[model samples]
Target: MQPVRRSSRLTRNTISAPETAASSSRKNSRKSSQRRIRCTPPPEDSEPEVESLSEENSSEEEEDMHEEILPKETRYENSRTAFQGLYQEKPDLLRPSKKPLSARFLTQGARERTSTVADAGLLYTVCDSDSFQPSIVREFVANLGDAEPRGDGVAVYVRGSLIEFSPSLINTMYCIPHCEEDSSWMDEKLDKVCTLLSGNRIKRWEDMSSKYLTVTNQVLYKLVCSNWIPTMSYTAMNAERLRFIYMLHLRKGFNFGKVIYNQIMRMAENTETEKKRRIILPTLIQQVILIQRNVPPDNSDEAESDFPKLVVKDKKAGLGSGVDSKEPDLEEDIDQAISFLKGIRSRLKRGEYPIQRKNEDSESG
Candidate 1:
């Protein structure tokens, strides 16, 4: 009876151990499933936030890149402005001897390959297509580079890219007017004029002026004023005289007699006190004016004559003074320039254009 009771108790203990092992296995599986869910990405609601952050980072990087790519010219211009401001506070630094930088050159290599007709056309196209100020037309070419020969296209670097325009394509843009002289000579003159006007030394007039002015006339005016190349503060002309001269050259249809009289009158009217403190026009300005006045108008009939009749008249009164509309006062420099130009023109008309004399020519002739 005792053996039978002990066997039944052992059976009951074995059944309870199996139930405990099964429960423990089920609990471990539940914990593993919970961990798997937690390890995964967030829900759809958070996607926008993640993308927005990425976009913001990208925008910041783009801005940084833009700042790095600013042009060298822009940096130089800013520096120059800053320097000018600083110089203003220190007047002594502006003394004439302190030769502030004169001008900068900025032209492209392809410009050299362009024919005069092409250049004129391109310039006109730019003027028509863009609402650029008229003064911009007068600005100088700064960085002219070498051009390849005809037939083979020239490479132009503009608008931040390199482009090739063959001579034929460029010629199609505009037909240049034919002149009696070689077209190449005209091309050289046009290029020179364009370069001087567009040079970086002076800001373009169109940028400064608001009204409408003919592009060709404005270019012509720039050529006339180019005589005063240096800053007037240090020269005998002074700022005022230079400005006056520039205006006089640019203004059209003004009576020369009245203008000259008015100028003299203004000087005379100045008080003794003011006259004592006043600075006068430079000898160079006087020389330039004198030269312009003395240059006789082209007279084909009298051109070759050794003694052309010089008509002298006075302006104020017939008895004491007769107005002489035609003669220029003969100053030494003006006479010299007039004589030189006359000789040059004569030689050119005679089909004997002067060429640089070589040692061979000297020896043979």
Candidate 2:
């Protein structure tokens, strides 16, 4: 036998520390003391108290643990609900419940009900339920050789009908490259498009459905009747020559070359034509009316003395003497009118007013 191993303890006070302390304290006091004890109730009366405390601790621990997990899923669900509420309140949302044909406001839902067709020559018509009917649309489609239906139910007919004027001219879809390139032709085009009107075509197109067609045709006829052939011919010729003209000036390194010279000539001719077409006619008409309205009194007759002479005085005097003399010459046109009326009366007396005479005999008999 070897010495048994044991766990080490503090050897100094291990044996008699508690007894020594008690004995020493008793020795110092030398007197005995008596104490009384009072009975009291325990904090809890039931076994369930321990269990309830333990359960509460466990629930608090669980809540703390749960809060440590990822929170994106919860945030995303809340955000989605908020976004849906906002979408419902937006003003531009299309309401399917509204009627299609009421034109006060154009809703996107109404766009679904309307249809369109583009015939030959870039003619497109927008047809809606209240205005352009399906029958008319189909007729327009049939007139075109073939038709194709778009996703929006618009049937586009190709080469079926003719648009009298180019669509580009109406909306400026296709703009002329040199429309404002300091060319007199541009001014002429503007003036022709604006003021020129054909009286005959105006009468003919009075019953036409399309207002643009009437206006454009009237302008076209006026341009033709006024001998605008030379001007338009130059336009057509110059339209083809724009590229060549540029090359001659830039690439050929020529100053005032044949191309440039020709362009100058074309410009001068176009300006003269434009002044005659746009300025002269309108100015002359205005001057004649001014004279007629501000006529001076005649000299001889007392009754006519109060009446003014039909003479137009030019305010821009000495600048245009040629146009000034021609102003009184326009009054000669009135005398010619009187002579024409006399001739018409003489013919009427000889039973030459064929249509009037026929109507008169029919009424008399």
Candidate 3:
């Protein structure tokens, strides 16, 4: 009975501290082994293989991305170059005179004849020479496409949009008569023009110097050359351009509106091919101003009034009308001449305008 009464507390106290320390030391060794295993490096050969595989995969991804982006970049570059070539620089545009030429400069007969031709009035329509915006002209020229035949009229692009500038539109805008037929430019017509300008039998291929022109014709010639079919060489005029002046001189029924449209197309074509050529259409500024303002041809009068009326000094007022009847200020004339002559020699060297011999018949015998 006394043996069964042995205390459980005494049995628990008899467990040794040494055995507990041994169990804890075994757990600490197991944890240390795990740390060594996790910290171990891969075998040398295996490391190279893994690194190579990752590098190859990354390189392939980069190559694929580059291939995808190359075409878009190339296409963008090509388009930008083409657009730049088309626009180039701001165009050198010839503008209209700020002041009207005195009627006294022209003969009485010449004045009467000029009054009869509706197209000639366009020259007298005063344009603010300073108002001409080269930037706008350049933009318009950049967007202008080749003229396309549309129904009875021809259409061209203006600021990326198609606009019809047919004879009807020209007539409506400028109040000039429209002709269904274009002017005939036969060799005979050219010869006739040369004859008229030279006051002698002349060939179409010959160049007529300004010195040979009559005083009245000289004034008309300058007006026509300056405002209409302008050329760099004022000393000598082209036969083709002379024909236009001839037509105006006769008050012929040919369509001057169509002539203007044709000249615009011709100038545009020339600009694309020739790098240094200047746009010599003064009247074009008016057309562009109308277009930019979106002024309809039907109601352009309000817009038209912005241009001063070209008043011709009456013969009765003579030189005393405060209009300087003398030749244009000498210094101003020299400046203009120098400006016109600039780059002309270079242009001639490029064969833009070949020197033509005077006709044997036209030459004084």
Estimate the Cα RMSD of every predicted model relative to the unseen true structure: 30.3, 37.7, 26.8
lDDT of each: 0.36, 0.34, 0.56
For all predicted structures, in order, the TM-scores are 0.17, 0.19, 0.43
Model 3, 1-365: lDDT tens digits are 55643576566656766788889989899688667556567667643577789899999999999887768788999998876776665222222344325635334555554563344446432232333444445545554466578865566665456666565565556555445453564233554565666555233323345555554556555555555566655546666666766766665555655666677766667887888877655445447446535633333222322332243322322121222222235686679789889778668667676433234435655
What's the candidate order when arranged by decreasing lDDT? 3, 1, 2
Candidate 1 runs further than 4 Å off: 1-127, 131-153, 157-162, 165-169, 175-326, 329-365
lDDT of 3: 0.56
lDDT of 1: 0.36
The TM-score of predicted model 1 comes to 0.17
The lDDT leader among the candidates is 3
lDDT of candidate 2? 0.34
The reply for model 2, stretches above 4 Å from the true place, is 1-156, 159-166, 169-328
lDDT of 2 by residue, 1-365 (tens): 76544533455456668889989888756543443444666676655568889999999999999987659998899898887787789735544465655554466533421211011111111111021122322233233233243332223232233321111222222121212233332223321222112212222111211122222232222222221222323212232232222221122222212222233234434653465432111221122223223323334313311211122222332222121121124476679889999999999999877899999999999
Clashing pairs in 3: none
Q: Which of the predicted structures, 1 or 3, would earn the higher lDDT when compared with the native?
A: 3
lDDT string, candidate 1, 173-197, tens digits: 3232322322222122322222232
Candidate 1 displacement at residue 287 in angstroms: 42
